[model samples]
Structures are given as structure tokens and as C-alpha cells.
Target: MTTNAELAARFEEFADLLEADDVEYKPRAYRRAAENILAHPVPIAEAVESGDEDAIDDIEGVGDAISSKIVEYVETGKIEELEELRAELPVDIADLTRVEGVGPKTVGVLYRELGIETLDDLEAAAEAGEIQEVKGFGAKTEQNILENIDFARTVGQRHLVGEARPLADDVLAYLEGIAGVERCEVAGSIRRWRETIGDVDVLAATDEPDAVVDDFLAWDSIDDEIESGPAKASVRVGEMRVDLRLVVPGEFGSALQYFTGSKGHNVRLRNYAIDRGMKLNEYGAFDVSELEADPDADPQHVGGGQRVGERVAGETEESMYDALGLPWIPPEIREDRGEIDAAEAGALPDLVTEADVRGDLHTHTEWSDGNNSIEEMVAAAENRGYEYYGVADHAQGPGVVGGMGLSEAEILDQVDEIRAIDDEYDVHVFAGIEANVDAEGAIGLSDEVVDALDLIVASPHSALDQDAETAGERLIRAIENPAIDVLGHPSGRLLNEREGLAIDAGALGEAAAANDTALEVNANPRRLDLWGSAVQAAIDEEAKIAIDTDAHRPATLEFVRWGVHTARRGWAEPNDVVNTWELPDLESFLH
Candidate 1:
């Protein structure tokens, strides 16, 4: 079956091919349509096939031309126009473009100039020194291509956490409905809320392994069965892989601990256990101090062996940690980066969670590119039990989509609507704007416009290819502006799409701390900029953090969960994040 993602991917290809040909305006239109198609709540392919006109029309940004192509694709499993574009270009647009500093136009240039159609071709050209000889190409550019080509070639094709987590939820829901499944939870990088994950690892506790495996294989979402066994199964779900492991309820906790690992953390933890003369593994914690050395056997039951020594704990994760005289570590902090030491010292941070997020400071409405009205968004915040809410739609600035950002007059008008909404809704609404910071570190808004906003989130939208020192200076300048309350998505990154900038987090953090500006941890899964390591650096410098969803609509407000976990990954506590403050305190901070 053709999924929404598959349909969206087709449109993305159309956009890329169009851009490669230097067809200016249509490419952006197609890309916008592609985003809408990806975000649309229904199956577009099914709508085209079933002749559901209303469903097709309901998709935003899809003009008649795009819709006709969709119809053609649904009917014939191919778009004739796209095929023609592909044939004309005759290049691996996606893979070639994945190389850092390579774009669709560059792909066109490379193809027309040097006949570079594949990774191998590009590598051969670069190696033969043919690339630098081309007009507008330099030795440095060639070197960078050489540097990034390997990553683009060898980088694991990981699924976005935002996409994978929901699929895991669906799998969990299905497993919960089974006859004998006791408990089920996701493990691995997804469990730790990493930006991208290799696969969805699900652990289910069940005495009836064969029955559970049979039902898992029977799951409707499975696109292909990779492998199946009595206690475990691996299945292909769309582009992602799902691995299911069934264990007896007693071993569930230990198994989860072992599998939900950063690898380094588990290694350090095993060492800790060894130093204590205890053994820790997927099986359980055992007192091995009294046991004689068995040279032929595995000392660590990491691969599932039962009762290696006098078993001390295994039934619960808490018990597993308690057996080591340490508290259970949150998965986000399980990178072996002093978390175990912190645990042993009883100094582990009270990390921020989704519930700790009282409101989102960065969001949008119909006044900008967002789909909903200000009232609808406020109502959604009220539903979430927020003490206060903020709507900082995109302000007129560099990098904003044309006709999508608000002018000075429009910004003031929206503030009025937001004030009224604040009175009507239970949640106090703050009028805000996400102003654009240009390459030279100047804000787009005037003084009057900045004063009108209750909060100002200045973010870089253009010229993100600055050097580390230059990017840091630009960000520091943005934060130093008294009107700017938060620096949103500090790096302007779109995970797997682009590496936005090379930034000196420590320098930016120090400047932000001195300026009293909060560094935002953007929660949109794609732009979880100021990721764990960067956020940690900023927090270490005593900079305040703002965890925001950057939501476009009400339903997207829940994206804060991703942000919260990301903040947790940086060792953020409730007090470190402004939104977790009391309403009055947050107001004071923003002002």
C-alpha cells in the first residue's frame, strides 16, 4: 500500500528534479505541497484511488497541477512528468544532494559539466582532480566534498525519532491488545529520545513467546518479515525496521536495562559491577564474589543466561540499580558521561520532563504560516493545563517563506487578538515574535516592533554557513539584544536535511549567560537544535534554557515532549528552564 510518506517522497523528488533544472518558483511550490502532503492526516494515494474529491481538496498547498500529478501517480504508479525530468537530469539527485555543500543546482552543474551521475562518479572526479578545474569550483570546495562524501556515503539511514516513536506507539498498542502480552515498552535510541534512530526496539514480557511471536508476525503494519524465532522477531515496517523480543516477566527489567543502552553506559556499568564483585547483565544482578572462576563460561549474562550466581535482583529496573547502591538513571542521561558517578554521589539532577513544561514560548497561528487561529491555539494550551502560553509567529525576516511572515502592522494587530484571547481562555497568552537574525547579527525588527512584542525570539534563518567563530559571534549578538528573550533553534539545523552551522556552544553560552537571554531548545523533532551536547555546554555556562515546541498548530503543541527529553539529555532541571517557572516568574523573565 502507498503510504502518505511515500506520496510525499514522490513530490519531494519532483521538487528536487525541478530545482535541478533551475525551474525557480515551481520547486518551492512543489516542496510546500510535499510538506502538506506529509503532514496531512489522511492517505492521499487512497483518496486519489477511491475518487475522494473532498479529501484531495482538503490537503493544503496542493494546487490543481500538483493534484493532477497525484492522480496520474495513483493510477499508473508513476508520474510521467517526473520520469521525463529524471531522464533529462540523469543524475542521482537525492544521494548527490545529500553530500554537504551539494544542492540540486550543484547536481545539475556537476552533471552538465563533468558527467558526475553517481557517488562513484563524483568520487572518481574528485580523486582525478577534475572537480577543481571547473569554473566557480575551488580546491577547498573539492576538499569539503571529499570530506563529506564519506559521511553521505556511509552515514546510517536512520529514521527520524518523530516518525519512529509514533510507529512504536502503534506497535505497543497492538501488542497490548494481544491475549497473553503482559507489558510492552520501546527500548534503544528511541527510548532515549535520540534525534534519529536505526530501528524501533520493542520489548514485551510474555510466558508464551511463540504465541506472541506469531501475533507479532501477523501484525498488519509489517511490510516484510526479516526473521522470526520463538522468543524474538524482526519485521520491516515501511522504511523502518522493528525488532521484537519477548522475555519472561521476571527478566523484563534486566532485559530493558541491557537493551536500552548507549553502549558506553552499559560498559562502564558492567565495570562498576565488577569492581563491586557483583555481576550485572540482561539476566539480573548477581553476587559473584563467592563463585569460583569458570574459565570456559561467560561471566556476564548480557546475552541472556539464567541465575549465573546467587541472583540478587532482576524483577525491576529500580531493583537492578538498587542492587548496585545507585538510583535508576533516566535513559537520556545513560551516555556514561558522569551520570553513573552522579548517581553514586546522590547528586543526579532532577531532570526536566514533559509535565515540567508549563507552556511553549515559540508557536504560530494563521497570522503567519500556521494553520489555526490564535484562539484555537490558546484553547489548545488551556486544554494542556498550561498556566500561560505564548504565540510567537514568524516575523518578517530573512529566510522566512514569502508571504508567510508578519509585517510590523500585522504584528501589532495580532497582539491585540492575543490579548483578547488571553482574557477569554484560561491560559494567559503572551504576544511574541520570532524575529530573523541576518548574517551580520542584525535583527530584522525595528525598535517599535520589538517593543510591541511580549517576547522576542531571534533566530538565524539565512547564511547559516558561517565559520565556528563567526556563527558564535552572530548568535552572541542576537542574544545580547535586550529585546530578544530567547535564541530559537540556535544552530538552525534540520536533522538529516542539513548541518546548519558549526558553532562554538561554550562561547554562545557564556555570552547568553551574561546577557540574560535564554537559549531555546527547539522541540520540533527536525530542528532539535542546541541538541544534548550543545545544550549541556550552555547549561554548564549557567545559561537559561527555553524548551519550546515551535508548533504551527494546536496538535503540534505536544511536540514539547521531544524538547523536554532533549533538555533532559542536556541534564536540564526544572529551575533551569523558564517555562517550568510559575506564571508570574515566567512573565518577569520574559519581560
Candidate 2:
């Protein structure tokens, strides 16, 4: 089964190969095929296994030839055409093109001109002044390549939604508060609530574009300036690229709609407009060629590029949806996850709200891995006006191998301290333990210790090597334990770095619901496991969800916004999420 990400990459590689050969039309075909593959609702393998090429054709933008290739790959576990193309080029393509700004043409040129086949070889050529000798290659390009090569080497592939999300929020809040800015939003993949991000893109409608761009460039946290134009600016905030675009109010919504794209989604929406006798573009819908309402015309060309629908007001996102006769689509659902279908069907979920959240369930104190003391953690929750908080510290068995965990005795000893301090706070603070689940599918803490706590968060911290079936069963057994209140970070994955344990999320979700155990959407930014898709599966199973920061410090508690965003992306509604329950309901659920 090729994951959407993997399939997308393969298509991109094919497109790049075509570009290297200067092949026309084929690149667009492959790119379109890739888009459809990523947007597919079910596994491509399933559709192909049944010998149904219609499944491929059913996907928007996928044609017969591409579908045939997909079927070929599915039937034979190989793409002969792609393999042939790769063999022909055979120039360490993936590696050489990975250099930022170096595309397939540049790779072809470098290989032909300098015989540079690897990163080290490229570095050697650049150092020896060999690259500038090639046509269309200059000193600036070589320097840029060298400067970004280290970045390309050291930089992680993509940032998880958890990690990229916070920085975006901080930047948005700052920009939104600016005096002349009318509306600010995150666009691109982030707006679509993608699982990973290459860069953080922000779009804003401002009365003062110059001032806004100036202020953005002057952001105190900016580590380096990449480029600055009149309407847009790019900066390197730590390792991530942050791009800010300023536009006039009249063009805001259209730009938002244009930029907040999965590309496939945009193409679909554009076709929808074309079918309705309207032309959709970055500026707004416009009158194009009118088809009909014509009795004699083909239905496919009825509205053929005509701009019949009303223009969205204010050029902002909300108005853009209104122009399309739909409500505003949230960022997460913009991935084409039946969002357009829901829009056309008029049955989209209301989605969860931050205000619906009543308490912070999973937290930590200095007794274990966290930085804040029990009292301080409680005080912070109280300051947030939370009705309650759950203090869950790490249990000893995972060991101090990471210098971030506690001993089982120390965890037990902290209960008395938690109880003693509980009396001083206005809100309820439930004592809990974040116990480790060993490789053999068993939690480290004894039932005696687990039962002693008000809540037990069982999580896999080691031996994340089991196959999907085995790991799913392991987690299902843990969820069935009457003593365990929650399953923590079901997949131990770390963003952009590790894949973590493999498990069948649908099965785990069913077990969670059946056993009356909740699943923790660990919102650590690095480990937003039980991601939006998994959260949706849990929702389907009637399982409860807790969005916890797993915060190790007081400042980190603010990460709840990311968790909330992720939950909303999963199409969670207020009632569907357990954290939305008030204190009494929470206690009943936990018990």
C-alpha cells in the first residue's frame, strides 16, 4: 500500500524526470495524476486489486494512461515506465535535485557540464569554480547552492503540523494585532492543515502594505532574511522559511482562496465554477464565455468559463466561500477530505471549538519530566479559567535514559505532595501517571500503583518495532484494561524524524470506544499522533478524545491551540471531544 505522501513523491519524481528530458505535456499529466492519487479517499491498492481502473479515472484529473500506469504498478509491484525513465537519466536525481532551488533542469545541466553526481561532488565543483563555467550558471547561483547545501543536508524533511503550527499562530497573532491589518490568515499547506509543512506561509489583507511588510521584516524573532519584495517577504525563522504576503482588501478573499490550496482542491473548485458559467481566479469570479442554461449545449460545457456567480465580498476567505454558495472551510478540511462533498451536500460538521474545552487533562509537574511544580501547574490552569486540570507525571520504568522521566517510587511519592497541594487550588487537580508500555504489550507499573492514581495514561515508550497488526493488538489490549483511563500517543512517531510504532488506527479506535477508554491526541508539536485522520476514525467509533499538550514546561501549555486546531482538522465537534465535557462529566468519563 503506497501512502499518499509516497505516491505524491513518486509522481513528483516522474514529473522531474520528464522535465529533465524536456518532455512536454507528460509532466503536467504526471503532476495531475499525483494530485489525484493524494486526494483519493481509499487506498489505491484496493481499487487496483479489484482490477478497477475506473477507480483511477474516478479521481479528478487522472486520465486513462496514468490510470494504466497505476494499475501496472499495483498488479506487478513495479512501474516499468518509471523504472526505464530512471535508468535513462541515472544521475543521482533525488539527491542532486534536493538542493534548494536546484530543479531537474539544473541537475541535468550540472551533470552534463560538471559531471557532478553527488552532494560532495557538487561541493567540490563549486569550490573549484567549475559550476560558473556552465552556460546559464553564475557565481550567485553557485554560492546560493553551497550555502543551502548544508541546510538541505541538516534540515529535516518536513515539520509536523504540531511543530509548524505554533510558530504560525504566534506570527498570526502578532500580525493581526497590527493597526492597519484588516484580516490575517495562514495559507498554503498550513492552511490546509497538512500533516507536515516545508514552510509557513501567511497572507494578510492590509490597508498599509508597506507598513505591514516593514513590520514583518522587522519581526524580532526573525533569524535571517531570505528575500523581500514589495508585496511579499520571506525570512528564515530558525530552520523554517516563513513567507508573508500583503494584499489589498479588495483582493483578500480571492487571494486567500487561491493561496490556501491543495492545488487539486482548487482545480476541482475551478471546474465547479466553470460548470456553473463562472470563471474563478485569484482576483475573484468573472464573466467568461457563456454556455448555458442552453438546452442544446453539452452539459460539460454548459457554463464553460463564464463568470455568472456573484463576487465574494471584501476579498477575504469568508466571502470567497459565500461566492461559491458555501460556508467558510476550515484550514484542516481544505485537504479535500470530503470538504467539497460536504459543501455540495450541505452536511459539513460544525467542528470543535476552543471555548468548548473545559479543562486541561494531561499535564506534568517537576516531580517527573515537567518543569513546573504541582502548585504552579495548577495555578496556570486556574489562570486560564479552566474548571479542572489533570496532573500526570512520568512513571519510572521507561528509565532516565532520556533524562526526562522519573522512577516509579518517585512518581508514587509525588501523589502525597499533589494531594497536599490540591487543597490550596480552586480547581480540581486529578493525580495521574504517564506509565510506559513495554515491548511485550504490557504497562510497566503494577495495577496497585496504577489504581492508586485518579487517572492512568498508558503509552508505548519502547520497542516501537512491532508490525501494524501486532502493534494494533498490543494497544487494543492496553485500552481494554479496566485500570487504564487513556491511551497516550498511540503511535510514538516524532515529526519529520521518525515513523514510530505501526498500528491499525481504526481497530485501536474501536477498542478505545468499547472499553470506555479515551485516546490522547498528544499535542507536543513533535508527536501529534492520533492525527486528524486517526481522530476522525476515533470519532466514527464513538471514542472520546483528549487533546493534551504533554507540556514539560509552563510556556508549553499554550500548545493547546495547536491541539485544538488539529482536532478541528479531524472534523471533531464540541460534543465529540471529551475535553469539552465539564468537570463532572470529565470525572465520570475518567472513572
Candidate 3:
């Protein structure tokens, strides 16, 4: 079994090795193939295993040579060309590249200059002051490497939900196609849409457990089989480990409940069951107090008791909870964090959903760092049937020195272009700027520039390492700005890269509430910035929230769901999100 992720990594390495060796066109081809493979809906290995050369070649950006290599890897778990390239470069490309400013070129240069192959070697060279001695490497570059290496080391191996979700969907699609498979679904933290996931868990209901297990083991994307049994199998695919379990149709509901757990939630649920003299386990909910069972027996064994009492529920999760006299709880809030109590009181908040979002308030176009032009981005929004779309390109400021942000003149010119586009489309196009908030919480742009825009998303770009109190005060000052409508990616954290800022979230939320500024949940997977807990704190203070994608491209606008769900995790309802409101209503609120 060879997963798309593993194959893509090999191709990426091939590209890196080629670049280090200065092999031109082939490297681009390899990189393109790798990107396409990762984004492919199904596992690349599956097409290869199907012996369908046409299907393999049909993958976007994949040519005959790459397809052949993919087939070779799937069949033999190795690619000779990649192996040769690895032997030639023999550098820790991935680890080195994780450092903030390091890239393949840097890696090649450092390796050629000082034989640096690992982070330890890089760190030692930097500490010894030897790296600055190399041509093209300066003292500052060396210092940055030293400073960021520790942050890189702390970066975990967990995959973001954005990355893991498609893989899970692919697995589910594959399982559903198997004969005798009655139902299949992904479980665990994935179901709850946790920002990062350790691995993927899937459950299926079928009488043919053996057949299901065999089919799963033979999945085209499997890199290696970890373990396989009659009812369960775990396999490694790409960079993710996928575990599958099979249960009888009658027990499917109970199994889903047991497996889709935040352990704390299940523990509390078991306690609730006991209080009602009911036994709840993977098999089903049963009235077991009347039956004789040893109190001193192991808990695992206790759950294995005979189905002696009434079979209250087993076929559905709702029924399982209904039998316990509790409403079915949504998985996202099942962390035993007052969800049970809320369910008891019939007070669960109606979570905001993707459908509730009427617009995206923070996006970019060619005017800034985004790839698409203004017309393209607005067209994309109109296609999504949005009532409004905010074009908030980066404003020239502290962290935007690289010509990535618009000058005042450029911003003014773009406003005219946006107004022109707005006249043509059904969607109300908002001309806005994502202005930088400096150390003292002053917006980077002038009053005239801010006044010209329909919206403003002020964000902290530099000086992200401030102490908690300073950070909180800084954000509060930004929120207090009358021109600012939203605070974007408040923490400025990238998932596993930088820690961003440490702030008192409650205080920040309170200040935002007072100032009528909405706090944003930046939905870009890398920065789900005002994460769930922070969102909760903000909601507690009745602060308005805006679930914006911070999208730079049209395809990425769909990322709104990530922000919407993150808001839900924070206990936000539709009314809490300004983007969920009608256009006239939202405009009034913004003013």
C-alpha cells in the first residue's frame, strides 16, 4: 500500500534534490505533480494499482514519467530515481525548510558551504558563528536560523483539519463502494472538526467483516498495514494513520457513539447511564441493574455482560441518548464542557453554519499578495451567491515592506476599480484594506485612506512576541479605533510555526464588545486565529464575531466553513456572526 501523501512527499523530495543539483525543467514538473497529487480527490496509488495508465496520467500536472514512477512505488514501495536523488542530496530537506526563512536554495547553499544536513548541525553552526563566514550568508540570517529553530522543533506532527478532511472523504468514498458495506463514516476528532488531528478513524457497518477488512487493507492509498483483525484494521496512508472498525448493523449506532469520543465526554456519559441504572457500551444501551454482575470485576469485563434487560436503543445515536433521557449532543461540544447540562436544560445554542454566512469580509486580490485579480475574486463571490464580498488587500506597513501591500495611491485607485466591479455584479463589493496594527495599536493607513474604504480589518503583523498584558492592551487599542470594523487573525499564529502573541482573550473580547468592533476567526487552516476558546471568551462578553476566510483566492472562499465551525466551537450562534446577517443589516452594524 502506497498513500498519495507518501508518494507526493517522494515526488517533492525529487523536486528538491533536482533543484539543489540545478536540474531545471524536471524539478518544476516534479513539484507540479506533487501538488496535484496531494490535492487529488482519490489516492494516487489507487489509480496506479488499478493498472489504468490512462487514469493515472489523467491526474492534473502528472505526466507519463511521473505516473510510471507512482506505479513503480505502489507496486514495489520504492522509486529508483527518487532513491538516487535522495542519495545524491542526502540532506534533511523537510526539517531544514521548516525554519522560517530557509528554503531549498538555502539548504543547498548551507549544505554545500558547511555540510549542514540537520537542524542540530545548523544550530551548532549558527551558535559557533561559522554560518556567517559562508559567502551569501550573513550574521542576521544566521541569528534568525538560531532563533526560529527552537520554534520549529516545538512544531508538532499533527495534520490540520483542512489537510486531513479530504483524505477522510476519500476513504469514506472508497469504503462505500465496497460490496456489503451498509454504512461508513469518519469518527473521532475529525467528526468534531478539531483544528489538528493525530490520525483518522472510520467506522463501517457490515455483516461481512472479513471482506471489509480485506478490502480496506488492499486500499490503493495504504502505505503499510499496521494491524488487521476480524473487526478492526489500522493502516498507514500517506502521512496519516487511518483506523477502520466494522460492527453489525444492529450495533452500529452504539459503536459510532463509543468510537466518536472525547474520552471525557464518554466518561461523563457512562456516569449518566449508571445514574439511570442503565449500562451503555459499544453494543447498545441496556437495563442491566436487574441482572447479577460482580461489582469487583474489571470495568471492561463489566461492560461485556449479557444483554439481559430491555434493549432500549442500539440502532441510532439519537435513540441511544433518548433512552438515557438526554437529547443527542452535537459532537463538537461533547468535551463534557457543559454540553450535557445544556442538553438537560434544553439550552444548547443553535450553532452557526456554512449556510448562515452571507459574505466574506477579509479577502485579497492582485492588488496585494493574492494571485487573482479584482474581477476574478468578485466573480468568484458572485458565483457563491453571496450578498456581499469585502476586498481587503494588505496596506503598506511594518510587516508588509516587500511590496506586498498597497501604497496609499494604489489603495485609492483600487477603490475605484472595486466600485466599478460592484456596479456590474449582483454582489455588493466592499472596497477595504487589511491595515496593520503597529506596536502602539495605531493603524498604518491615513484617516483619508481608511475613510475611503467601506470596511477595515486591522491586524497585528509584526511585534507578535509581546508579553500577555501588552498584547491585550495593544489589541484593545486597535479595537477602540473608530475606523476599524474587524480585528483579523488576532493572535497572528501559524498552526505549528510561530506562537504569535500571548494576550488576555477575555479582556480583548470585552474591549471589542465595547468598541463595536468584531473579532475575526481567520479561517485559513494555518491560522484559525481567535480559536475556539478565545471565541468562547469573546462570546461571553457579547462581542460580535465575523467568520472570515482571510482568503487570497476564489477557491479558498469555501474555507468560510472552517471559520464558521470554529465559531460554533466557541459557542457562537448565527446572531453572533456579523457576516451571517443580511446586507442592509450588516452595513448598519458596520457603520
Candidate 4:
């Protein structure tokens, strides 16, 4: 299958080739094809297997030539032209392209001129002042290359969600506060809540592009300025480069549509537009004929164009969708994941909202590894206007052998302690234990101890070293226990650290649904376990989800924002989320 990452990488490589070769128009075509393929809802290989070359042809920006390339790649697992291009410039295209201010042309030039095959070699050459000896390469360019090499190495390969997410939030908040900004969104892979990020891309709708660009360039946190233009600006915020683009209100939807993509999604949408005799661009959708309007026409800041097949019509994202005969796709589901089919069938799920979360079902306290006191945790939940808060501290038995988990006696004591603190807040607080699931699929907490707690969360804390089938069976049995209310952080993943337990989430989700147990989409950026895909699977089985912060501190409780984003990414809706249910309704589900 032409995965989103594979397609995006190919298209970007093509773009770099175009720049290196200084090929005009053709690069955009390839990029557009890449974008559409990235956003395509179904697997491209499936579409290819169906012998529907029109599937490739339908993407906007993909003319017959690009379509033929796609067909060729799918048919033979190789693209002839791309292969030839690779043969001509056989260096690691992506690695070389990663250098700051360096593109394909520079890579080719350096590779050909100095035999610079590696970053080490490039650095050595720069230090020896050999790079400046090459045409078009100046001292400044050499210095920039050296500076970027360290940045590239330090950034490693991937930016953790925990680290990149805050930076994104800071940028989004700054953008939102700016004047003339109507709607703002963080686009690209970041928006998809992908595990890692390379660069951050933001798109905003503003009436004044000039003012918006000025404000963006002046952002206080920005360490360096890259480029600022009418439609787009790039800046280096710390080590991460942030790109911001402005679009008018009319073009907001289309621009958002174009920018908030997996690239494949955009290509697919573009194709859809083409099939409908319309043209889709970053600005908006236009009748294919309207795009032919004076090639020398001045680029305006307006949103969309008016005119559909010679008859003048409206221009707007809503109208664009109407023109295309489909509905607007939510940005989260824009990864080309069955969204088009949902749009065609009008079967998109009513996604869950923050308001639906009436209570927080999983949280920690100072008694365990949590940094916050029980009172503080409850108070924070009350501050958020939650009706109830479940305090599921770690139980000291089973797999929680060495951690801050409480002993069975300690748990019984905490229940009474929790009851004692209950009168201090208006919100009801339930005492629970996050019991470990042993290798045999039995919870560490005794039945008597489990029965005493208001909420019980079963999770795998030890034997994470188990195989997929063992781990899956272990969780299934644990989840099947009527005493368990929610399955916590199913995968146990730690950002950039642990990979957690391996299991078939589909089977676990079915077991959870059968047992009427909710699955936890751990809100911690590091572990967003029961990730979007897993959550989607759970939802498909008619199982409910609990979007919990799994907070260790009061501040960490705010990790709920990321958790909510996780659920949203999974296409979870109010009804599908257990926390969204009212306290009484939720309590009823407790066995």
C-alpha cells in the first residue's frame, strides 16, 4: 500500500528534485499528486488493484503524466522516471535535503563538486573553507549549512508529542490572540497527532495578511526568522522551525482544506474536484475553466472565485464542498481515512466533544506516584466543573510490586481516607485502584479489595516484556473481570522511551465491549495509548472510551487537552466516550 508517509516522502523528494533541477510546474504537479495520495481515504494499493487509474487521475494537480507514474509504481513497485532521477543523483535525497536552506540542487551540486556524501564530510569541507570555493556557495551559505547540521543531528529524527505539543500550543495561542485572525489551526502531521513531528505548520484565516505576517515574524519566542511573505512565513522557534500561512476568510476553508492535509488527502480531494469539473487550490475551489482565467492574472487575497461552468456562482469552502457534491471533512479525520466514504454515504460519526466529559474516571494522587494531593486533584476537577472525579491510585500488589502502589490493607485504608476528604468538595470523589494485570490475565487486587473501591482500573504494568498473543490474552481476561471499570493505557507506551505491551486491540476492544468495560485513552502526550486507531476500533465494537489525563499532578491534569485531541482524532463522539456521560449515568455502568 502507498502509505501516507511513503507518498508524502516521494512527493517531497519530487519537489526537491524539481527545485534542484529548477523544473517549473512539474514539481507542483508531482507535489499535488503526492498530497492527494496522502489524503486518499482508502488504501491506494486497493484503488490501484481495482484497475481504476481514474483513482489516480481524479486527484487535483495530477495530470495524466503523474497518474501514469502512480499506476506504474503500484503495478511494478517502481517508478521509472523516479528511478532514472535516482540513478542520476544517487545520494540519500531525504538526508541531504534535511540541511537548512539546502535543497536538491544544492545536494546535487555539493555531491557532484565536493563528493559530500555525509554530514561529517560536509562539516569537514565547510571548516576547511572548501565549500566557498564552489560556485554559488558563499561563506554565509557554508556557515548556515554547518549550523543546520548540528540542528539536524540534535533534533534526531522525531520530535516527541510531549515536547512538540507545547510548542504548538504556544504558537496557536499566540496566533489566536492576534488581531484580524478569524480562525486558526495547527495543520500537517502535528494536527494528525502523529507520534513524532519534524516541523510545525500552522494555518490561519485573517483579513489582513500583511499585518498577520508582521505579527507572526515578531513572535517573542521565535529564535530565528526564516522567511516571511504575503501568504506564508517560516520561523525558527527554538530548534523547531514553525511555518505560518495566512488566507482570507473566503479562502479559509479551501486553504485549511489544502493545508490541513496528509498531502494524499489534498490530492484525493483535488482529484475529486477534477472529476466534478472543478479545480481545487490552496485558495479555494474554482470551475476548471475559471483557472484558465488570464495566466498573467494578478494573485489576489480573496478566498475563492465566482463562476461554475460559465454560469457565475459563489466562492467559499461551503460552496466549494457543495460544488463538489460532498460535505466538509473534519481536520482530524482528514488523513483520508474513510472520510470520503463517510462523506459519500453521510455516515460520519457524531464526534465526541469536551462538554460530554462529565467526570474524570482515571487520575492519580500523592499517595502514589502522583505529584498532587487528593484534595488538590479533586479541587482541580471541580474547577473544571466536573460532576465527579475518580481517584484510581496504584495498587501495590501483582505487577506493581516495586512502585508506589498501595498494599491491599493500604487500599482499604485509602477508601476511608477518600471518603473523609469527600465532604471538603462539592464534586463526588470515588476511590479506586489501578491494579496490575499479571501474566495469567488476573488482576493483582483481591476481589474483596476490588469490591471495596468505587472504581477499578485494570492495566498491564509488568511482563511488558511478553509477546503479542500472551499480552493480548492477559489483557482480555483482566478486562473481562466484572470488577474492572476501565482498562488503562492499554499499550503502556512512553514517549520516545518504552514501546509498551503488544496486543491485538481489535480483539481486546471486542472483549471490553462484551464485558461493558471502558477503554482508557490515556491523555498523557507520551502515552496516548489506545491511540486514535485503537480508539476507533473500540468505538466500532460499541465500546465506550474514557479520555483521562492519568495525571500525576494538578498541572498535568491539563493533559486532558491532549487526551481530548486523541479522542477527537479517533472520531470519538459524546455518546462514545464514557466520561461524557453524566455521573449518575456513568456510575450505573460500574459493576
Query: What C-alpha root-mean-square deviation, in Å, does candidate 1 show against the real structure?
Result: 3.5
TM per candidate: 0.88, 0.67, 0.84, 0.67
Q: What is the lDDT of residue 296 in candidate 4?
A: 58
- Name the candidate, 1 or 4, with the larger TM-score value: 1
Which window of 10 residues has the lowest lDDT sum in candidate 2? Answer: 300-309
Please state the error at residue 354 of candidate 4 in Å: 1.0
Q: Comparing candidate 2 with candidate 3, which one achieves the higher lDDT?
A: 3
User: Candidate 3, residues 164-250: lDDT per residue as tens digits?
Assistant: 787898899889999979998889998887888888999999999999899888876676899999999998877788999899999
Give lDDT for model 3: 0.84
* Candidate 2: tens digits of C-alpha lDDT, residues 1-591: 333434555776789888887787678667756644644445676677777767767775567777777777666656888999888777766666656557688987787677777788888998888887788989977886776566555534676665466568768977987888898888998987776798999998877888888888777657689998778999876446889999888888888888989787787777776665556777776544443356676443345443343554436667766766877777677766678879878888998877877777788877765656788888888888888888888776542333556666676777778788788988888888887777666776766676668888888877665678778878888898888888998888755444567777778888889989988888766677778888888888888888887865565677677788788878888887787887788788885
Candidate 4 lDDT tens digits, 1-591: 333335545666777666666577577556646645544444465567788777766654567777777677666757778877777766666666656566677887888899886678788999999999999989988887776676555545776565566677778988999997888888788877776688888888888999889988777566578988887899876457788988777667666666667787777776776666566666566665444434354222112354233322223446656667787676667767777778878887787776767888788887886656888889988998988899998987555523678888889988998999998889999998888777787876677887788999888776665679888878898888889899999977654445567778778888988998999999876688878878887888888888988876565666777788788878898988888887788889987
Instruction: Report the number of backbone clashes for model 4.
Output: 24
Clash total of candidate 2: 8
Model 3: lowest-lDDT 10 consecutive positions: 298-307
Candidate 3: deviation at residue 467, Å?
2.4
Off by over 4 Å in 1: 1-7, 23-26, 33-90, 126-144, 154-156, 294-306, 366-368, 372-376, 401-424
Taking all chains together, the TM-score of candidate 3 against the true structure is 0.84
Any runs in candidate 4 off by more than 4 Å, and if so which?
A: 1-156, 173-184, 205-215, 228-230, 247-250, 289-316, 397-402
In Å, residue 456's CA in model 3 sits off its true spot by: 0.9
